[model samples]
Target: MIDIVLLSLLVVIAIAIIRMKDLFAVVMLTGIYGLLSASFFVAMDAVDVAFTEAAVGAGISTLLMLVVITMTGRKEKSTRHKPLSALFVVMLTGGLLIYGTLDMPYFGSADAPIHKHTSPRYINDSMEEIGIPNIVTSVLASYRAFDTFGEVVVIFTAGIGVLTLLCVARSQKNDEEIDSINDSMHQQHLVIRIVAKMLIPFIFLFALYVQFHGDFGPGGGFQAGVIFASAIILYAMLFGLSTARKVINQTFVQVIAALGVLLYGSVGIVSLMNGGNFLDYNVLSSNPIAGQHLGILLIEWGVGCTVASVMVVIFFNFAGRRAFQQHKKQAQDKESSAC
Candidate 1:
């Protein structure tokens, strides 16, 4: 019943997002949709997935969209409705997707091929093989560590791509303008600043807990990294971007992001050096189980570092771009006034 209700809400939110022209409201609704989706994931007993959706989908994603809106403006440009054409494409796509699923086994069917072939092995032997209570972690960190490494590389590449495309050249004048803007925000929100300052520490602590506790609980590097990035985001929001940048040097953050991918790859290379398959943690130490534990721990750290740094880098670039644009506009206005 709860799942049904949540699904209904998700549908409604999706339609609402499609119809809405106010970009800010749409961003907010998108965040709400993410939260609802997270709730549904929880209902489906996928708590780890839920944690990620809540952090990335609802939290960091929303903040990033909001930052983007600062430059893009609040309202969407109106476009002529193409209802018939859009509807036709949507219907065709939906039909094909549904048709594709027609021959699949029923959801959670015990007789499914996956259950017979793959899941049983993981379910029955993963504890003994990987020696971790959380089968999900074992599968992710050990069984499919290469895939996870690829995912980290993808994220790292995306951060580099965004930086290349959107990064502005910083100057002394731009920095002053950014500082002034932050000062204005800082002075206006005394209570928020105090409350956020209090919460930021706890948030960081929780992120670290999630980072290290995934072996036993419903959290891991990806989720923890987002949560950590979110704290920095919150600090920037309350204290100002200039101050945040001062504390977290952009050059250092970029280096850390690269280091994370290197760290994950290094583990795989080391495994090969040990005469084991790439990312095969069994050979990292004399005791296979101990090696598995160490490898998982290291790779999870790599994931955490990369994810957190990329998120911060993206936010910093967006916020800095906004500041630069604002400064340019101000200069233009001053010239016009002088004329």
Candidate 2:
């Protein structure tokens, strides 16, 4: 009974998302839909899945779409599509879902086929096999660590891709153009600047906690990385780009980014030197428990540092050029007026 109501709500929201006229409004609705879906998943006992959807689906995707909108322009063209084609695609997807649902297990039944096969092994052996209390953590960080590492690499690649696309200084003309755009905001928002100054330190502290807290809770390198980067971005937005640059020098940001990966890689090298497998943490400290904790902590810190630095670097490289150009134009305008 509850399932039907929730599924109906999802379908209604999905339709609304498509039909919304305003681009920003549609984007926001999509985020709301994602949050609702995450909540529903949590109600269904899929906590980990809900966490990821809440974080990535609602949070990251919305933020990124907003970024893209800002970089391009505020408005979106009303894209006209053939109604028949849209209907065909919808029908095809719905048919597949309907077919798949026929084979799905009954909910909340202890003797379900899925529980009989997979859950028993993990339920029985997880504690003895892995030291971690959280089965998901053990699965992610130990058993399928290669996949986690790849996910990190993929995230790194995404930042790199954004850097390549937006951060890299393409042409002198483009630089000049960016500077021109930046000049429009010469009169700064004093309130936001003061507020950001007050908040940055606390944000950094929170990021550190999130980085190191994964052993007991649902956080790790990835969450820490995003959190740290966001703090820097807030600083950049509140203060002028040049002032922000003064605080986090371009050279310094680059060095820190490079150092982060090197720190991570160096851990593995150290493990190898200690006559252990790559990234094996037993040899990091005299006590294996202490070593494991230290190793994970260090890697999380490295990830946070890199993510934060890289995000700010992207903002600066792409947007800073515009600000610089704007300042130069403003200065020239004043000089000409005085003369």
Candidate 3:
């Protein structure tokens, strides 16, 4: 009865949120949707998945989308109410989901086909095949390590995409131009700068812990990279881009970011060459355990570097573009005066 009520409330909220016309309201509703979905997942006993959805959808994803919305402005004008392509896509996907569900075991059945088949093998063989205590981790890092590696590649690609889309290099030029146009707009915050400087080192140390502690807990490359990048972003926001650049040079940062991906890819290639399958980390060290540890470490570091550098690059580019724009404007002003 409680489940039914909660589910009904979720449905009602979803309808209300969907009817919201304001884009700002929609963004807020997205957060609400994330929270509700996470709640539902938790109720279903999928805590890990729920935690991820809550953090990503509510925290990072929403923040990122808000930033983009602020940068790009609210909304595009609608051409028509009819969305034939959208309708077709939705219909096709719904049809597929229904078709798949039709063959699925009945909900809450103890003797369901799902439980009767393959479940025993998973319960029994997991210990020997993977040799890990935690079945989930064993599956993710060992048995299904390939899938996780693919995900890491996708993350690396996304970092590259963000840098490219945001015109990180051009940001410097933009910054100069902004300064020129808004010369009187320059504001100082010495207190914040000092505070940020004090915290920067500690922030980085925590990021290191998160990156290295993935074997035992929920921390990992994705979290570590984002945390490190966020610290730099904070520094820039508080102190100024010039100060941030002094700490992390643009050219060197880009090289490290590229190197991270190369490092990860190289490990896989090395394993392939060592007579084991691709990414078979057993070749990294004499002991299988040591090799697995080494591989995880290398891959995690690669992920951290790429995530941190690419994020910083995006922030720098945005800030840089403003600076360049300001600089250009100043030059124009001087030329006009000379005329």
Q: Candidate 2: lDDT of 301?
A: 66
lDDT-best of 1 and 3: 1
Considering summed lDDT, which 10 consecutive residues are worst modelled in model 2? Answer: 178-187
The TM-score values for the models, in the order shown, are 0.96, 0.76, 0.72
Cα RMSD to the true fold for all candidates: 1.4, 4.9, 4.8
Candidate 1, run of 10 with poorest lDDT: 107-116
Residue runs of model 2 more than 4 Å from their true location after superposition? 1-10, 41-60, 79-81, 109-130, 168-189, 273-275, 283-288, 314-339
Please list the C-alpha lDDT of all candidates, in the order they appear: 0.92, 0.68, 0.70
**On residues 215-298, what C-alpha lDDT tens digit does candidate 2 reach at each position?**
677666666676676777676665546556667778788778778777776777887898878877768888776666666667
After superposing candidate 1, which stretches have Cα over 4 Å from the reference?
Answer: none
TM-score of 2: 0.76
What ordering of candidates by lDDT runs from best to worst? 1, 3, 2
Clashes per model (N, Cα, C within 3 A): 0, 4, 30
Model 3 lDDT tens row, 1-339: 555665787788788765666667778778877887878777876554665567556655565666556555676555567788998998999999999999888767888877787667766886665454445455555556678777767766776776676553445555554444443343466677678889988988988887777656556666677778777777776656676677778878888888887887787888888778877877878887777778777876777787678767766766665555556677899999999
State the TM-score for model 3: 0.72
Q: Please provide, for model 1 over 193-268, each residue's C-alpha lDDT reduced to its tens digit, 9 standing for 90 to 100.
A: 9999999999999999999999998888999999999999899888888899989999999999999899999999
Superposed Cα deviation of residue 139, candidate 2 (Å) = 2.6
